[model samples]
Target: MTSRTAQNGGHYGAIVVGGGQAGLSASFHLSRAGIDHLVVEKKTAMHKWRDERWDAFCLVTPNWQCQLPGHPYDGDDPNGFMVKHEILGYLDRFKAKVKPPILEHTAVTAVERHAAGFRVETSAGSFTADAVILATSLYGTPSTPRAAERLPDDILQLHTVDYRSAEALPPGAVMVVGSGQSGAQIAEDLHLAGRKVHLATGNAPRCARFYRGREVVDWLWDIGQYNITIADDGMGKKRHDTNHYLTGRDGGRDIDLRRFAQDGMALYGRVKGVSGGRMLFEADLTSNLDAADRVYNGINALIDRHIAEKGIEAPPPSVYVPLWEPAEEPAELDLAAAGITSVIWATGFRPDWSFVGLPIFDGTGYPVQRRGVTAVPGLYVLGLPWLWTWGSGRFLGVAADAEHVVEHLTAAVAAPRQLMAQAG
Candidate 1:
């Protein structure tokens, strides 16, 4: 999408804040409806994917699921995962295909109601629109724990966003906190690089990369897992669930933290505090590991049930066995004693909605909307996890949600015009 100067903006049918996949998808549907709209982005369209991700980052899902609106994956390796560059290239092509009217390097500071409909104040200038779509994703703010500040000033620290490679780190052991997707993957990255790594684990779940003669994701898709919606499923709160950890790096594979422990990677429980150059941890390392594996096997059990019920001819179902177990829960580790020169915090992110001037949020600061359409007419939120379906945030489902929201938006926009014509 080409960047336009925001200063010339007078009024638009709609204004979409954000230029990521979600915003662009909204733009695609708006353009199809001949809705004169503008997408205002804080940075370039692919800034998040390009800037925040590490060098070795790749999609956890297969390339086939990277389906943008009107642009399905036509790549030769549909089942394979796209690395960082390949993912960006796909998005760049989609941007070219959509060619949505967007303004880059424009930070939207506030969005509030106005006489026209809504007034969006941006760093560049202000614009008015009849409707607004907040396409900025849920994970906008990087969240590091307050305990991080208690560490010694000399110890080098980095968030997952700033971490690049093992070689970039100082010459010493590394401590990684939070065992979610990013923590697990980056710990493996360092382990493979022959670095001494200490991992403080969380209760994030895991899933098998492949099971029953096909990828588990393929099975999930076939079993209608992705089709399950938040409103329809009992586990609607899965939106807030920690993402199941696996890897798409070097062709997909299961990230068994137990395997990492067996391979000499130091494993610890959740970090409780950092003080006096020592990191204190809970005595629940074994429990945390077992919790992750239970989810892994639980997913496998789900696939097995699907296969048996359908009588599908597939490989025999199997269960996962832990390769290693922590002998004891280490309560505290002196960073200086362990020679840990650096630390990586993969604690994930929180949503930033301070700019939104609407009372659409719930107690948790999450926008309260029904499949992207907010109670406040003319304002909506998209790209949030579990907005409608489990796939809502990913490329697999954003297109569908965008279409649904825009359809509602189109009807809303037409109702007034129709009433005016009838009155005339």
Candidate 2:
């Protein structure tokens, strides 16, 4: 790129790019540590969180768990899950409290390595800092599979990220791809809205928020799960582990699929490919359905253990069976005959790093860092779940991770920067 230089230079101690939860949390720590820094956010105050989320979306984590140091959630319903709006509100309020010198409505254009540090160029201006922390999230892109690209133009295909409401959907039947939370939720929603719905199920795994009537999070914690940070293969393991649980149920409560069957939603095995205005796949959804059952049993067992340990009198949750299942293989559902004109892909998301010009990323689009420390000097990450523990990167546990990262960043910038003193 162009040689790094700036004309109007008022040197900043550090610069943070992207003002998402990760960036804001890092900035919060920097402020508490007495570090003077500039935060460059691409959008207006908290727009990233507010504008991007779909309708009726609540954080997968409970409201009580949403927090940052000195800025924990203190709303009326602590136990309920916070919506995207509430989260955006909290971040804006936090930014105001810290008042980090942020320049909004400007996107980072390019970043070049300077002699002493790095030169960060933005829409509004250029800034030089001793360290640059990029807080752009992994969920930056909406990944559509290649097979989906071959779909006929007549059928409507939409990623879950872009889907807002049933009003946006065209008339006829709806076929939801993938069996993840979004797929289950959207399928359930569309079905209840009085549309013929076909759920193209794939590698689905059921989850329980509570098993045996005890919170699933508590069970995972008690069993020392999510603690496995830094697996043996490191980047390979991290990339492989990135995925969402298919079950919409949490704490043993039904989300979408539990009641979806009651609305006449049909379950089918994987969709192999689409051709001749028809979607072909094996009707033998036997193994896939079996896998779902296995997970249900496993979660129930965990709850049973919890009950036995606590000596609770209540019985386990009663299982609700699905309405219909495909019995044979290579089952073909003509998109036209099924009257399914639209496809909603709630399959899952994979991070894209085409814009991120850092060498620290692995092939699978995950950042290469050990507890947020990168091979590139002065490069650090915070607010990643399971960065050091299962909870480290999760909503409930991210505050502690942010605390650690802020502590480290403060030391990185404060211990040096003697040039300013000498120049003064």
Q: Each candidate: what lDDT?
A: 0.91, 0.66
* Candidate 2: tens digits of C-alpha lDDT, residues 225-336: 5555565445334534433443222322444353465557777777777777777776546676667666766766766676678777865555535544444554777787
What residue pairs clash in candidate 1, if any at all? Answer: none
For residues 1-424, write the lDDT of model 1, one tens digit per residue. Answer: 4777655557999999999999999999999999999999888997899998888999999999988999998789999999998888899999999998999988899999998489999988788998999999987888899999999887899999899999999999999999999999999999999999999999999989999889989999999999888888486687788999999989999999888888889999999998798999999899999999899999999999998999999989898988997889999999999999999999999877989999998888888889999999999999988899888999999999999999999989888878989999
Which is the leading candidate under lDDT?
1
TM-score of 1: 0.98
- Model 1 bad stretches (over 4 Å): none
Best by TM-score: 1
Sliding window of 10 residues with minimal summed lDDT for model 1: 1-10
Clashes of each: 0, 15
lDDT of 1 at 192: 95
* C-alpha TM-score for every candidate: 0.98, 0.82
